[model samples]
Target: MIKAIVNVSLKAGVLDSQGKAVHHALDSLHFSGVSNVRVGKQIILELDTEDKTTAMADVTKMCEELLANTVIEDYEIELV
Candidate 1:
């Protein structure tokens, strides 16, 4: 079996409203030293295959097809 870890994040130059909101909340809570809070998602998948190359290709296809919005978001896949 193989495990695929996918990280999804907004592309650069895209506005991150959720991150901004969290930043504001942190500032309100007196966390002033923090900056550029970007929010992202991690998806962990356990595949039935044992080959690392196959697992990577399958996960990359999944990300390109459904898991990530390629127009505005970027994804990184790690096989374990």
Candidate 2:
């Protein structure tokens, strides 16, 4: 079996209002030393195959087609 972990984040130059809100909330909570913050998505998938090549290709396709908005988001995947 293969475990796929995907991380999705806004592309460069994209505005992250959610991240800003979280940052402000943290500040209000008295968290210090945080300069900038960005929010992203994490997806963990379990597959029945251990073929790295095939799994990577499938995960990449999944990311491009459904997991991320390529126009505004970037994605990376890790397999275990």
Candidate 3:
């Protein structure tokens, strides 16, 4: 079996309203020295195949097609 860890984040120059909200909340809570905040998502997939190469390809395809919005989000895939 193989495990694929996918991280999806908004691309640079894209506005992250959720991240901004979190940052504001932190500030309100007296959390100082907080600059920019970015929010992302992680997806863990377990595959039945043992081949690392195939798992990587399949996971990449899944991220590009359904798991992420390629137009504004970037994804990183890790295979284990």
Candidate 4:
């Protein structure tokens, strides 16, 4: 079996509203030293296949196709 770890995040040039909201909330709470904040999504999948290369490819495809929107986001995959 193989495990796939996927990270999805907004593109570098894109605006992250969620992160900005959290930053504002932090400031309202009197939390100092808070600079930039970014939000991301993580997904973990357990695969029945044992082949590392194939599993990685499949997971990457999944991320590209459904897990993330390439137009506004970038995704990374790690096989474990």
Candidate 5:
């Protein structure tokens, strides 16, 4: 079996409203020393196959097709 991990995040120069909200909340709570904040998502998939090449390809395709917004978001895939 192959374990796939997908990380999704907003692209640079794009505004992250959720991240800004969290940063504001943290500041309100007096959590200091934070200069910037960004938010992202992680998706884990367990595959039934053992081929790393195929698994990575499949996961990358998945990201391009549905899992990520290619225009605004970037994704990285890791297999374990």
Candidate 6:
């Protein structure tokens, strides 16, 4: 079996509204020294295949197809 980890994040220059909201909330809570914030998502999948190369490819295709929005988001795939 193989474990695939997919990290999906917004591309640079894209406005991260959720991140901004979190930063604002932290400031309101008196949390100082907060510079910037970014929001992202991680997806973990357990595949039945043992081939690392094939697993990586499949996961990447999944990302390009339905997992991440290629226009505004970038994704990284890690196989373990």
Q: Best-fitting candidate, measured by lDDT?
A: 5
User: TM-score of predicted model 4?
Assistant: 0.94
Candidate 3: regions farther than 4 A off: none
Q: Write the per-residue lDDT of candidate 3 for residues 1-80, one digit (tens) a residue.
A: 99899999999999999999999999999999998999999999999999998888899889979999999999999988
Candidate 5 residue-wise lDDT, 2-64, digit = tens: 999999999999999999999999999999999999999999999999999999999999999
Clash list (residue pairs), candidate 6: none
What is the Cα-based TM-score of model 2? 0.96
TM-score, structure 5 vs. true: 0.98
Which residue segments of model 4 deviate by more than 4 Å?
none
Whole-model lDDT for model 6 versus the true structure?
0.96
The TM-scores of all predictions, comma-separated, are 0.97, 0.96, 0.97, 0.94, 0.98, 0.97
How large is the C-alpha RMSD of every model relative to the true structure?
Answer: 0.6, 0.7, 0.6, 0.8, 0.5, 0.6
Count clashing residue pairs per candidate: 0, 0, 0, 0, 0, 0
Candidate 4, residues 1-80: lDDT per residue as tens digits? 99999999999989999999999999999998999999999999999999999999899889878999999999989988
Give the distance in Å from residue 3's predicted Cα in candidate 2 to where it truly belongs: 0.3
Residue range 1-80, candidate 1, lDDT tens digits: 89899999999989999899999999999988996899989999999999998899899999999999999999999888
| CA-lDDT, candidates in order | 0.94, 0.96, 0.94, 0.94, 0.97, 0.96
Per-residue lDDT of candidate 6, residues 1-80 (tens digit): 99999999999999999999999999999999999999999999999998998998899899999999999999999888
Give the lowest summed-lDDT range of ten residues in model 4.
56-65
Error of 6 at 9 (Å): 0.3
List residue ranges in candidate 2 displaced over 4 A. Answer: none
Per-residue lDDT, model 5, residue 43, is 98
Compose the digit string of candidate 2's lDDT tens values, residues 1-80. 99999999999789999999999999999998999999999999999998999999999999999999999999999999
Best by TM-score: 5
